[model samples]
Target: IKYLFINHYCTLDNLFDILLYTPQLCRVNVKYLCQLHDIILNEIPIILSNLAHITIEELDLPFDVFEIFIKKMTSKLQVLSIGIISMNFTYLDVNQWEQLISQHIPYLSKFHFEHYEKMPSLSNDHHNLLKQFTTFFWIKQQWFFEIHIDTQLNGVLKKLSIPFIHIGHVLNSSILSSQGIQLVISSVDERDHDILLNDYIKSIIISTNITCLTINSSMISCVLIELLEILHNLDSLTISYSSRLLKLHGCSQQSKHHNLSTTMNITKVNMCYVTKIEQVDFILKFCPHIQYSVQMILNYHH
Candidate 1:
């Protein structure tokens, strides 16, 4: 059979037998994905070693379902993509998530967390969960970890040591304050400019080894300046909001010279949603050895 479709009535034992015979199966999509929690608990050793790729649509799954699945599959599995079809926060608990990561999915190299019912909350449970996952071997290595939180996760992110971090929410000072983070992809939707002027931005400039930086249109001018100051090793920088550059009154000649002298190795810069041509000119003048690409958008988007 090219595919396998197991109904809710299928027992866990039957599912195990089906997986054993279909080692070459490329795509396995489950309907009520959470219902297989029992099967995973019983046949983790066998199921994880054979399964290749798993996609779950509805996310009403208990935290344990994921925990058991990841624990078993981390050693052999390669790609895991979970699509949360619901918005219910109760279905997934952050504490259980931590347990799953620390105890189970430490080896995953590529992880995608998408489409949750509600945004993730940064409670003790959430912090602990991310802490556990952040330290997973997958994250510790050079893997890409993407988190889509409707809420904030800086508190949790601060404690973890991951090479790359992508946050799709309004960031607080605590989120960007960490020094070891190498790559930051963020979307800022708020209008407040003062929050971006805090010491956190300065810290990111001086401390972070960030080489790839991507931000949405709502980013502030001061944030860009801070980024310019500390991007000593940055190779690729993508900005979704170009119009914000207009508000950057003027950089002191010394500051401009300092930025150029510091960012000697920058090669690629991506600018999106810029309304003024001057912004592009300004960046090109500062980074004379770099290449630039500009995209025009009617609205600021990331």
Candidate 2:
């Protein structure tokens, strides 16, 4: 069968029987596999050698248990997500993992190893390893994926899926020189996004090549208007009044339109959350190409 779901815990005997009888099984979750067979540590390698040949495509296992197959070869295994509950990955230096990747799991494309502990910093070895790979990202506390730049980077960010996608693309010169380059951070976790906006966004934009931004924040309001107004290319804005937006009853009028639109600048304005209908009329007064509707709130809606 293509799927196998074991509702109860499995012991050593059950795993051996699975290897012998379930040759057709393509997926197996031994999350509850728990305690290993007391088959003496000397004999564990023999069982591990046999287990390595199984044609499984995905695996879920404890971090300590997976250390057995770190440098071992496995065929057809493409995806792996394991817990770092009881292990310290910093000890496994990047070169060690490079040997594992280049020699062992050559077919692996998507990998997520999560931990609940405080995040660790990437050492010099980490930077050396990342420079050789085509694409890889760090999943920060399961909130979002970040692909940051280092002094040794080549400024080529691949289009891939991951948490808090920290990206920088080289336009005219190297990415370091691309001043208006933008880092588009998107996520369903609004709380994490807000935290990123408050803490990390400023430092990142100031130190790196990030200017234009297209994002959705559930925490936007009048208190942050002056903050957002300074963004380089502020296009496609989303404002939700459900979070207590200051009403227009006691708002000041525009001394002059100042023409917020330019010939080749931030011209396209999308006014979403039509709580006040007059907002659309005000935009038409100074800006054209007005986009409305709840669906338009999404950057990819067009």
Candidate 3:
């Protein structure tokens, strides 16, 4: 029965008992996955105890329903992945979310939550609860991960010691300056002028243990220089920018002089852009030690 579901209707809940006990079942589709989750919540206590990793997509269930399921099944769960149709969070608050996470999912090592458009707003008390969770649980854990949040969540994140990856608006300057951060991959829409004007970039450079950095093209030159100086132990760096912006900044002389003489430890540098090949060449010239390669790619005409 487990083999049948493993090979055929793996998404359905009919084989969940078999699957849960099988020890080898690691992956399941979202539609049938929830059914199995419901089964585990209702029937067997030890069914989900062996699950090492679980991922569910297209979940439209209420937050309370999901919280109950998590509290029941995630005692030994090490890796958790959830995908909602979109982040129109109307039914959950920070307290409820924090309570669910704290009571259940105590042993989780890796967690992934995806929100489509917007995240739910937590009250001040809930935010404080989140801060407590970050300090007590997230920081103490061996591995912790979260995605999708605006600058405001940085306050909570500052207390966490785990390496994290954030994919949203630039974090607050104070948050970037917090201690124990080791990696940052920022995906910012360059057209958003407000972020470029923000002081967070300088904060990132002056503080933190950031060793790996990736940024969009519109990152200001002053901030980039500051980052290069402060991230003396950086190993991998990627920078993406638009062609028109590259032209405005000029490529030739700037590229030749762009090397971080102090950051000899950097091993990889990836420069991605649309328009000016010269700018790419210039970046290559600056980082003479970095292996350079380029390919012609179509531009986004807008």
Candidate 4:
């Protein structure tokens, strides 16, 4: 297989065994890479010379264990994206990361790294952690960083459990040094979508630099209007559309107050969790210039 995607939990041994068969795999995306139980390392390395892209959504394995897996690749991987829910800050060690890339994946051209943890649990050493990423190594690679902390604002922000959001790619380097920004909002309960999104947008240093965005939060008309007003440069958007989208059926009080005269320059729109056709119609009204579109309807009761 040239491409493989694993969404469920997978142990290291299970992954190794699977890789053993897919020697010609060029790309692999694992949603969650976890260590269910301890397993002995394979004496023989499984070479994936053709594999050039690797994206691990959640790295549940420790740094050392993951290092072993990287070494086994023995290939010049061109793209590597990793998201980690770190228990130990060892993953923040810039020296180890530099050395690993230098020795193992020397030809790696693109590297996307994300670290997730409860911000409140962090000690004063959080500054030190942030400083490590600002080193010459990261700066030279144009990997600038931003830390999102969940805060209480008029009792709105406090409702969020995991408020991290990965605001996707930066289209213009001149606008922001960072090539991409990912805001991960890890939450268990339903978030106050409008207020939370507004608060998150306010935290951004340069919101205009963010050309593409994915809103996993529950969709609402006020939130959509707020996004249109604030994100003036947004070119593409991905959002959920359900019964809440029906809220925009008529000119609501919020829509009446806001000026909808400014036409959005957005060219692409992707909708998920769509429950009705009217939801699509509502979006089209706001984004008149959408050149490309995609919608996913999970359950069609309409």
Candidate 2 Cα deviation (angstroms), residue 283: 14
Question: Compared with the true structure, what per-residue lDDT tens digits does model 1 show for residues 1-302?
Answer: 54566545444345556766666665566655545334534543544344555655454555545454455432455455665655334433435554565565554445555533222222334323332323334333433322322112333443222212232212122222132233443433334343344454444344434445555435445556655666676666566654353355565554755656555665666676666666666555555666544344544444
How many clashing pairs in candidate 1?
A: 4
Q: Candidate 3, residues 1-302: lDDT per residue as tens digits?
A: 11222223243344345555665444443433333354334565435445566666455666766665565453466666666554335322436645665667655666665444322222333222222223333444432222332332334543332222232212222222222233443433334334433354334334334545655434545445544666665655566665233334433335424555434455566666555556566445435455434333435565
Sort order, TM-score high to low: 4, 1, 3, 2
lDDT (CA) per prediction: 0.46, 0.37, 0.45, 0.62
For model 4, what is the error of residue 126's alpha carbon versus the real structure, in angstroms, after optimal superposition?
2.9
Candidate 3 Cα misplacement greater than 4 A, ranges: 1-27, 31-46, 72-75, 85-102, 118-133, 142-213, 218-302
**On a 0 to 1 TM-score scale, where does candidate 1 land against the true structure?**
0.49
All candidates' TM-scores? 0.49, 0.40, 0.44, 0.55
Model 1 pairs in collision: 71-104, 86-117, 87-117, 98-129
lDDT of 2 at 266: 38
> Tens-digit lDDT track for model 4 on 65-168?
88989997767698899887766677877788889988998887788777766534444454345545555666566665544333332236666554443322
Candidate 4 residue spans exceeding 4 A from truth = 150-158, 161-173, 177-302
By lDDT, highest first, what's the ranking?
4, 1, 3, 2
Model 2's alpha-carbon lDDT is: 0.37
**Lowest lDDT 10-residue stretch of candidate 3:** 168-177
Model 3, TM vs. native: 0.44
Off by over 4 Å in 2: 6-23, 30-65, 70-74, 83-93, 112-144, 147-216, 221-302
